[model samples]
Target: MRQPALITFAVLCLPFLLHSVAARAQPEPQSTGSDSDIAITDFSKPSSPGRTFAARTVINAPVQKLCGILLDYPEYPAFMPNTDNASVIQAADDFAIVNMTLKLPLGKIKKYRLRLEPRNTPQTCHLSWKQVPWEDLKADDTIADTSGYWHLVPHPANPARTVVDYFVYADPGYVPFGFRWIVDILSKESLPKTLESLRARAAELP
Candidate 1:
């Protein structure tokens, strides 16, 4: 009778012990997206003279496929509603100079030439850009100067999912005080739409 009672007590404690162990062993859930695992370093600050905004998303596509779409300048105008036109003037060694016109909400268009650099790694592709100063409007009438980077990082567990990290900086110029509001709205809204468009276009790819 004593042995049976001891055995029953042991069995009851086993589950509780195992559960505690399991709870301790479980890891925390991480951010999932295009650059999910990659560590991001932010150089922008509110105190800095330039204003910066950043956004990210997890794209349900491979990194290679995403990179291809990003570099597809000519087709951008057709699939990306915000883009009025895009043309690549030069390309060499994973870098290209592209001229693009973005449609603003006020029925105006803003054009800029961006120098794109692509970094190809085993599991990721990073793209960064700087505005060509010459392409920027004359300082007297300019509203803002913009620059940013995009990262396509592959998910470790799922090869089909890629995380996209995007950062944009805007330096609102002197003349148009109202332009600041437009820039702020565009910074928040435009990038997510662009990512959605990229996903749609990738799914349609043959």
Candidate 2:
């Protein structure tokens, strides 16, 4: 009777012992590791101009390098998805004005001007842009209004990595009938693609 009871107890404890060992062998997660980059897109929040869109990711490159790539407005068409042309009309140490033309879904062309500012601190780098009026370009012909910012921070666990956050508020005033899908494409679907584009661009650079 004693032998049978001891065998039953051993069998019950074996699984728990194995699980404890497995847990102990597992490695601790890095603070800002690529595994923690979990991409998230939220459009549930309502805003005055358009729906709010926010997404985040981790890039393998350092923050400084990514900041440089973002400030290079003229090179946007080469890597930025749906961008047809980007012309910087004004440039200065603190800000830049860029005219961007985009080829949207169904072959529609949208053109707008944006005033971009790059802000930097010891801990983070940020690039914010808002649509501005161009005398020749009418509001009705282009996007109603748009504003967004990209925030970059260095990874705490790794010096060579960066965490990036992207936020967008866009109001495409009047989308042609049956082309309402463009709104979703711009906000929801494009978020991850935007991160991927930036990551690829950084990898391509020396």
Candidate 3:
């Protein structure tokens, strides 16, 4: 009787152990996609204090060329003015952890550490960041609630141009009801600049 009970217990525990091992063995994602198809779409709600912004552009280059340029972190400041510094702190087969410092016009510089995960293939990628409670700005005033995703879809009409889509959700910290205008203004101004800079960078690629 004890032997049978022990055998059943082992079977039940085997799956959980295997799952843990599989999670540990999984690799990080990579970014490798074409130009042209990268675009931003608007997904923000008016009533909420949160904001979302996206942009896309067509490039006169191949997907591999564009991916090479996109993955070059140290060169971000050269193309994007708002980005002061960006570097890959960790890298693996299917994912990369990147640290970025941005010079914002809102009187504060923002630093974010993003984890890039690949899905579907090297052609498609997703980047996500969780707000660190103590490290976040306006920690005492309000909580930092932000998440974003990047998708790379191939363009059937223009194979040379890849459609890159960006989606961001942000909750403005410590803003009064009437102060929601700040969120609107920031989203409108900053998102366009970011897209334009990205477009310019893609164009500059060899």
Model 2, CA-based lDDT: 0.82
- TM-score for model 3? 0.61
- Residue-level lDDT of model 1, residues 128-185, one tens digit each, is 8887755446554333567878777886678889877777776645536566655544
Q: In angstroms, give how far residue 77 of model 2 lies from its true place.
A: 0.6
Ranking by lDDT: 2, 1, 3
TM-score each candidate. Answer: 0.70, 0.78, 0.61
What C-alpha RMSD separates each model from the true structure? 11.3, 12.1, 9.5
Top candidate, metric lDDT: 2
Residue-pair clashes, model 2: 0
Q: Which stretch of 10 consecutive residues in model 1 shows the poorest summed lDDT? A: 34-43
Candidate 3 Cα outliers beyond 4 Å, as residue runs: 1-41, 46-48, 120-143, 175-186
Give the alpha-carbon lDDT of every model: 0.71, 0.82, 0.60
Quote the RMSD, in angstroms, for model 1.
11.3
Candidate 3 structure quality by residue, lDDT tens digits, 92-187? 867677677666555645566666655445554444444434344445343346666545555668767665555566665666566555455445
Instruction: Say which prediction, candidate 2 or candidate 3, comes out ahead on lDDT.
Output: 2
Q: In model 3, how large is the Cα lDDT of residue 57?
A: 52
